[model samples]
Target: MPFPIKVCAVCSEEFELKPDKPGFANRCPECSIPESTGDSSTKQRMDADERKNASEANAARRQAMRELLYRKDS
Candidate 1:
């Protein structure tokens, strides 16, 4: 089956919407390519650290909520 035709959100060009297309469904492949920013490894590591910190914070928030909901009356 032929891929569906989609208009690019950025350049306003028509492109084939394939299953392996990167970035967003609304954006064309050319527009989907991410601009390089120095070392990718370092950036990935920083992103991982940020995700870890965010996950920890979320866990703490859930724990606080659980405590508040399950705490016994004094």
Candidate 2:
């Protein structure tokens, strides 16, 4: 295997090359990526919730408007 003679910036580990992971060793072979948190489930859930809440709010507003338009101001 071709390896570069480099050292990790974060862990300070020795490797064949400086990893593309910013500060990790290229030889670490995982968890070397600085931005790779791996999972985004919470973010996805929050996004879904935001969309759902907006949709619900819109629906509620439309319903209120419809009620007002037909409501005989009693």
Candidate 3:
């Protein structure tokens, strides 16, 4: 039997689907390869670290302002 035609989600190209294969792909072969090359976990971790650093900096700035306002001029 001939394979049925399916459209790729990423490239919007049509491809033949293999019925015998266990894993079926939503995107065509060309578009799917690039998607897997990047490490998502590393990217997420970097983003989280950046946010944490920004929060700490803001807190330190506010503390300095409070100390300046409370100090008595000699």
Q: TM-scores across all candidates?
A: 0.51, 0.35, 0.39
**Higher TM-score: candidate 1 or 3?**
1
* lDDT tens readout by residue for model 3, 1-74: 88778898877999887655333477666665654556676564548888999899999999999989998888
Candidate 2 deviant stretches above 4 angstroms: 1-46
lDDT of each residue in 3-70, candidate 1, tens digit only: 99999999999999999777999999999988775656754454888989999999999999999999
* Deviation in Å, model 3, residue 7 alpha carbon: 0.8
For candidate 3, give the lDDT of residue 70: 94
Give a tens-digit lDDT track for model 2, residues 1-74.
67567655656666666435454444354446556477666454558888899999999999999998999966
RMSD to true structure for each model, in Å: 5.8, 11.0, 11.0
Ranking by TM-score: 1, 3, 2
**Which has the greatest lDDT?**
1
Q: Which has the greatest TM-score?
A: 1
